[model samples]
Target: MEAVILAGIARRVLDELLRNPYRTIELRSARNVMAVEAALREAMRLFLTYDPFEDVSTGTEGLLAELMEAKYLETRIPWEESDEREVTICRAKVKLVGLGRVVEVERRKGVMLARVRELFPHEMDIG
Candidate 1:
């Protein structure tokens, strides 16, 4: 299911960001930031491509929603470029429409700031 894949990707991104040496940095030039964006885009591509028959567990939707709320991953309409939209990941469902177009999955900025504040409050003054 897309939600499972997305949750996995979000967890990986968070782990990578936390492990990176420049986790405290705010600049986009940081390798971790670029990698996070690239990973998100790739996950979008995967979402657009894959159609599996496995059923998702009831708990996955909650997990995905939590990740989205935490700003780990986001879904949006590509052309409108508006704020994040609500996306429901259906299990074993085929995407009949919009197969030719791309879905936008973005890495949100709040994750880093919130993570830093939670994990390294004393280091906040150093940045």
Candidate 2:
């Protein structure tokens, strides 16, 4: 159950980081486990808002289980900041839950930098 919550938080954080407009994001609390748990709670709150019909009584365990079975479970964490101090490398430690194996997916700084440009190509071109 804790894994499920952590996975959800990682997914949400990664998603937000990917979409972040800043060229460099400074996450001072990235290493704190309690901060991570707080992020999980916030993500869960956001999820509940999207689907008001979902039963709150069933809790995150059931909801996360459903997401896992549907193949929608993926997570990412800020693994390291670049030596050059230019980019942050986010890693997906748990690619899939309930698969009986741990799959790692590292999103390098170069890739994420390219992704940000891809997201707003016109803006980059204008500058």
Candidate that scores best on lDDT: 1
**Model 1: per-residue Cα lDDT over 34-87, one tens digit each:** 433443443421221121113222211211111211123233556656564543
| Model 1 residue 124 CA deviation in Å | 32
Per-residue lDDT, model 2, residue 117, is 8
- The lDDT of each candidate is 0.25, 0.23
**Pairs with steric clashes in candidate 1:** none
List where candidate 1 sits over 4 angstroms from the true fold. 1-29, 44-127
Q: Where does model 2 exceed 4 Å of error?
A: 1-4, 7-58, 62-87, 99-127
Which tens-of-lDDT digit does each residue in 17-107 have in candidate 2? 3354222222222332232233344331111111112222222221111111111123444456544433333322212211111122122
TM-scores of the candidates are 0.16, 0.18
